[model samples]
Target: MTKEISFIDLGLSEEILNALNDLGFTKPSPIQAECIPLLLEGNDVLGMAQTGSGKTAAFSIPFLMNIDVNLKAPQLLVLAPTRELAIQVADACAEYSKYVKGVKVLALYGGQRYDVQLRALKQGPQIVVGTPGRLLDHLNRKTLDLSNLKGLVLDEADEMLRMGFIDDVESIMATIPEEHQTALFSATMPAPIRRITKRFMHNPKEVQIKGTKQTAPDIDQSYWLVRGMRKNEAIVRFLEAEDFDAAIIFVRTKTATLEVAEVLEKHGYSCAALNGDMTQQLREQTLDRLRNGRLDILIATDVAARGLDVERISLVINYDITLDSESYVHRIGRTGRAGRAGRAILFVDSRERRLLKNIEQTIKKPIPEVALPSKELLEKRRLAKFTQQVQQQLESADLEQYQTLLEQIQAESGTDLETIATALLRLAQRDRPLILPPDPVFKPAREYRDRDGRNGERRLRGDNRESPKRRERRDVGEMDMYRIEIGKENGVEVRHIVGAIANEADISSRYIGNIKLYETYSTVELPKGMPKDILKHFERVRVLNQPMKMSLVAGKSSEGKRGRKSNQPESDDKGFAKKRGRPTAPKF
Candidate 1:
């Protein structure tokens, strides 16, 4: 079909229709159109669509329209498994509520002050979205008054079941007025979840959508197997290493979203942060800038970014691997919208091998592993970007002031025009390094000899060089140098370093270089010309309060260093499930 479908045909209000038009929603997905009309008639919907299938709007529009913003008590309630999901559902409600006056959308989750949520609750929001734990807490404390609740939505119900929050969800539903309508959306209706639907929902209209479907098929997906130590640096390196008109980098947490957005903005990324904490006004303003092409890289948590169908998002970077197949599809869905071609990248950890299997199985396609952008490619991309910028300046710039300076510099310095232009080029490429910088954390070159006539292969001073029967198994192939700041002085052991890096940066202990602990620093062997951003962050990253500044030493050192090749876990995990049944940690 040439078109997906439109929400207007579903009979949304003129105000909502205008808002949708403003948001550029050309048509509703099959799920939205089918569910919206039924819900507006106050039907209890049992929506079963693949993740990223526009289910948020299916429930949100009807929920928003029914709320009497004038009556402040919570009228509609949605329970999510994770803090992030809770926040995101609330955000979608907020967006839809923009036209509906006086009704406030509040998100309740932990990891922050409860007083803040309580204060907002006292202000009388028309709708409440919350994780089960926090919602239960508020319910027990009497901060959340759901006596007037007319609608209850159970989002990611399968995940809540997996996380053992079904009891809370059932309890919450029980507490709500039995006469009210209820809608439950789950990727799969497991036995436990189905029980709730049977018990609570009255003559619910079921919408079941299946398949290990990639949500936005128009989007092209790629990934960089970056060493975990320096993820932010890797991000920065890759930004210079590629060309994107606009991108939205997805991180799992509000802290990460804000932190990465800040770093990108600082380094000239035209980026902004979208999270639950930002005001409704500021959120709208940021989206406005993004739509107008004034911003790139809107770093966001999944919850804060729901219904963010920005056609301008040319790239989607999964800074963290999503917890579920559905979220993976949903986050990437933000791009490639409206039949536009989009690009998406997922950052995976080698330890989560199980996740790779799950994702591949879930998507029913093999997502090939790709190497990080090489230093040479980064330089090329940077140079090309720099040239394009220069051309733009040449076309639009006011030249009189620069022309006088060019003429004066030519006379005084006696420099050729090429030389002057080269100087300008250098200036442009200075802040954003066109080349990857060498890291200090990796091991020294093994083939090379120390000034003392000892080969870099020789062990440290305390080691018994002549000792036989070494228990440690050395790889048969060549080894490379990789540096780290952790050492004996830092109370670090080989195993600790291995475990931490494996978990945090996705670096396998097998590929790790020779670790020589020093009083102030230590080094190991790693593959050459490493992605500088990942390397730099690893160099300064703290392993037990002492920063493990991981980097590749310039030259090769030992055996077993052939670069580079690219999981665990239980569960058939089949039968169409949502990404991250619970909220925060689904993304690795």
Candidate 2:
């Protein structure tokens, strides 16, 4: 039997090893252990590993040691599919090269001013990480010099291909010096990628790390199809309904971590944000609190949550799904450790269904679709918890002083002891409402007919046609009418509008009612109390590859201008009544 190798055994330089120790990395992941030695030997290498298999460290460490700080002019170039991934890769390289002085690492990508990238380029950074499109842009501008480059890396090669940047990637690769060492890392080796390796790489050493793509078998995985409900509200319901000792909710960006954590805390949840922007001290403190139970939720980005091992983290929520399928495995890997049962829940909108399908296929498992918990279910769970807590207090509490006080109050007020006790209970529970009021905007939830007219799972009633009288009576209250620019001419079906609104606004489809499509525009009726930010976000949503151009229709006259009563079935411009029950968007 062979033994596993540690990071120290990979024969890394003292400075690199010291930085690794500071970062608390005692061992290497399989890909890291395999590639580091070959990369150090000055050979072209190709690494195939899942997203979180430590691929960044595998390539970064060896290249960091080999780069010459004195002759710095973009010595090592890393190409990524997106700006986010580019920033992450650059950050990893910078951290690994902390003790190795005079080696500057810069990230160049779109959405930022060219002056910023140009300034960094003039500073003569030894390593550059950027997306294919932006890198080519810099190359064309002559701001970035590839003349002194020593090595090149194509990170997430498959992702770049999927994003239609393969041509740009090939062009950039052709511009780099042919004598430089090259490495390509991707989760999958498609035919194009294989051809690239054969053409550009010279006898490349292939290191394939397998079996890390699947999460723990004990982890129960499921997804919640978010419609018109706010993500925070849905998350709060989950926290209220589920029994979890600890949880980690994953978001896409650093800003999202703080934003989500703030919302959760405002709703009275014990949560903290973990992101790359935090100081090491703050990060350690947040993790310590999570470990000691002072924090119940740790909202984090993918990079911040790397190497996090907390046994009590029995729940993982993918609040914002990542584009990378391997990241899904990494996120859920936080739970179900050490032979313990765990749960992972993903939130997906209707548009991102394709990403969801890719993840399921990559992991080779079907994630069951779980319905959102009803308001009744959440209230029941809260009451049951309150009861358990009261029972525990009664069994162990020292009540002599309270009993005496209750007797004194009873005598003074001539009230029964039970009445005084009930008054005290109400005071204690007054801060948080025990029961949530029903929302009239939403139709009563029950078995809803899918667009196919089959009895599918519960759907919002707005998707179904209501008689004119029923709609007029049901929509009598404060309902706002909004108009969207896309209509029948652009394949603007009713299901498309409902699915987009429900998914984007995090609202349930049932709350969205009375969709009327015309030759050039469509009108939708929703509750009047919509949040401003949600309204703004809804406008930017694209339906059928066209911006919705959603705006308030303004006044009751606009509804009459459309010439449709609340109960009237939707019709085309020619006044042909559409089908009452329309099918929904096709599921991936």
Candidate 3:
């Protein structure tokens, strides 16, 4: 066998090594071992590795070691595809450069206030990490400077392409000095990404690490179909019934991390939220607590939980399903480490079956569908836990004084000892009862048969037998027609529109009515009198990287048809309506 290479073998700086040692990373991963030496030598490196393969450290250590603390005008720029990943990269870089003083790192992304970023930019940080769009916006506003840049790294290049930010990336790269070093990392080298490497990189060294497709065999994976109850309620019920030492609940957004953690805390769970907004010290302290068994549940976003290893984490709950299979694997991989058996439970909504299917295909195994924990099981577990607590108190505590007081009270009230004990038990459990209320009965949506005579049980679509034109002409009873700005030209399908609306709006597929596709845009039927806030929210919901700028069609007549002919475009032989200008109606 080949000798194992440590971080020292890669010639990283003492400061970086010290930080890595503190972070519990002794040996470099395959990618890190191969790329760090080249990066330190000022080579343009193109790396191909799967997610969670230590790509951040492969580029970060060398980059941190090369930073010039004297010139704090963005010596290095790292571009990520999303805000979460941007913050995550900045956090990792900050951690690696902790010992290397005077190296300021700032994360710039959307959703954060402009004044906050403006103030940070004014500080002249040596390292800048941001999404392509937000970075470009700052560049346009002249708030960011990269004149003294030494290198630029693109994290998740392929994801940037998929999210329609390749142009912005190219623009940002153009603004950087041509002689600076460039490093690009991606899971797959697609055509566009390869073109970028050719245009931007100079004789880049290619490092490809072939990853083994394997999940822990000790992990028992399953999913719960989210139907009748809210996800927070479901999580509380599951915790009450299931036996687990500790768990990490994964959510999608930073806001959701706080929201879910708050709900669990209200239910008396010893949990905390981990997200991008937390300080480095706070994040490390939170993880330390988790490692030592002080925290039982951790509500976190995907980026916040990167590189998280805890032996006590016996379970992982996907409170919100992940967008990709690789993330699903990584999330579940948090458990079942060190030859320990673990459990992974995914919560699947009705509209997220396609995402579930994608994960199944990737893992090459079907995650069995399960119902939520029943009331009987929850009550049984609660009673057992209460009894165990009482037993522990009886065995460990000195209750003689309490027993004498109870006897005196019994004598004064002329009641038996049994009655007094029962009354005290009632008082003790007044806030939290030993029995749970019955859950609402879940009614699954109706499944329609496809044209192939197969039951499309989990598909979020209407009848497959009807043509688009026929379905479009059907009377949309109690539903309103709205046009969304994405169609055949953007490679949007009926299911894409349906899934986007249903998943984003948290509405049932049955409530979404007929859909008509055109070249540039499409019209979807939705329930009438939808909240304005929901309509405004849909304006930002993306389908196939295109935003659904949804707007209500003007002037609906009694026959469920557009009152004005201008709003309805005539259909051709292929059932695709001809392109038209913007609708005359006002936006929601």
lDDT of 2: 0.75
Q: What is the C-alpha RMSD of each candidate to the true structure, in Å?
A: 18.5, 13.6, 15.4
Roughly what TM-score does model 3 have, to 2 decimal places?
Answer: 0.50
lDDT for each residue of candidate 3 in 1-588, tens digit (9 for 90 to 100): 225898888777899887876554667778888899899888999999866667888898888888899886999999987655676687678878979988888888765556657766776789999888889999999888888889999998998887778898999999988779888999898999999999999999999986648654568999997765567667998887767888999987777788788888898889999987789999999999988888999998876887889889889999988744667888999988888788999998655665686678667778898788888887687788789999998897679988888878988999988888888877878657765565543235444233111111122243231124322232334445688988786666786676667556554454566678888889876655665646776886656535699987732323324432334433342553332222222111
What's the true lDDT of residue 355 in model 2? 63
How far residue 242's Cα lies from its native spot in candidate 1, in Å, is 4.1
Pick by TM-score: which candidate is best? Answer: 2
lDDT of 2 by residue, 75-135 (tens): 9999977665676687679778989888888887765556546656776889999887788
Candidate number of the best lDDT: 3
How close is every model to the real structure, measured as TM-score?
Answer: 0.48, 0.52, 0.50
Task: Give the better candidate number (1 or 2) by lDDT.
Answer: 2
Clashing pairs in 3: none
**Residue 112, candidate 1: C-alpha displacement in angstroms:** 2.8
- Using TM-score as the yardstick, the better of models 1 and 3 is 3
Question: Cα miss at 137, model 2 (Å)?
Answer: 1.9
Worst 10 residues of 1 by lDDT: 579-588
